[model samples]
Target: MAESEHSSSENASMDSIEEHSKQDSELEFSDDEETLIIRMFNLVGERWSLIAGRIPGRTAEEIEKYWNTRYSTSQ
Candidate 1:
């Protein structure tokens, strides 16, 4: 009984981790979202939270990272 309970818990933990990874992967922005982000950046400057608000399911940090990777110049 104890071993079965432990196994169940481990399976649940693995499932939870896999679900989290799936959600993270699903967060990738589409082309329309990227265009919106660019337009929002023009309108709101670096207020990433505001930009994210316009784009559903996106967090400020994610939007900022995308902006930096796609738009910022390397120095």
Candidate 2:
């Protein structure tokens, strides 16, 4: 019973840490970054790594996700 309680506490702590990391990883692009991403998309077309390289402090995956969320049409 005591071991089970300790395990549950550890699990809760891990859950909190994971949630915090998810929040931290969320994309918060500035106006300039958004404009740059759009212009880069027009120039390069889904070349997320290339676009991300041009934008400071952004990852390819994050930029791709942002593009998809903002631009992709649901079917």
Candidate 3:
């Protein structure tokens, strides 16, 4: 029971996708973003847009729309 409560509290702390991100995670990425981003964007498709700071000048709205459009069509 204690463990379950702890896990729930941990999950609650993740207010947004930002929760999944940490400064350390950024360091894990290679300096060569171009080569890496292409593969990620391909796999994630429109969802890639939701990822902040992935590409300069790409707004959250634009990314959200891209993903929502894809999501609606698939449904």
- Extract clashing residue pairs from model 2: none
The backbone clash count of each candidate, in order, is 0, 0, 0
Give the alpha carbon lDDT tens digit for every residue of 12-64 in model 1. Answer: 99999999898667557899999999898998899999998998888999898
Each candidate: RMSD to true structure? Answer: 3.5, 3.0, 11.3
Off by over 4 Å in 3: 1-50, 73-75
* Candidate number with the higher lDDT (1 or 3): 1
* Tens-digit lDDT track of model 3 for 1-75: 999999888778765556556532433434454454545567775555545367665555654554455445565
Which is the leading candidate under TM-score?
A: 2
Residue pairs in collision within model 1: none
Model 3 compared with the native: what TM-score? 0.29
lDDT of 2 by residue, 1-75 (tens): 999999999999999999988865577788899999999999999999999999978889999988888889884
Off by over 4 Å in 2: 1-25
Query: Model 3 has how many clashing residue pairs?
Result: 0
Better of 1 and 2 by lDDT: 2
Question: Estimated TM-score per prediction?
Answer: 0.63, 0.71, 0.29
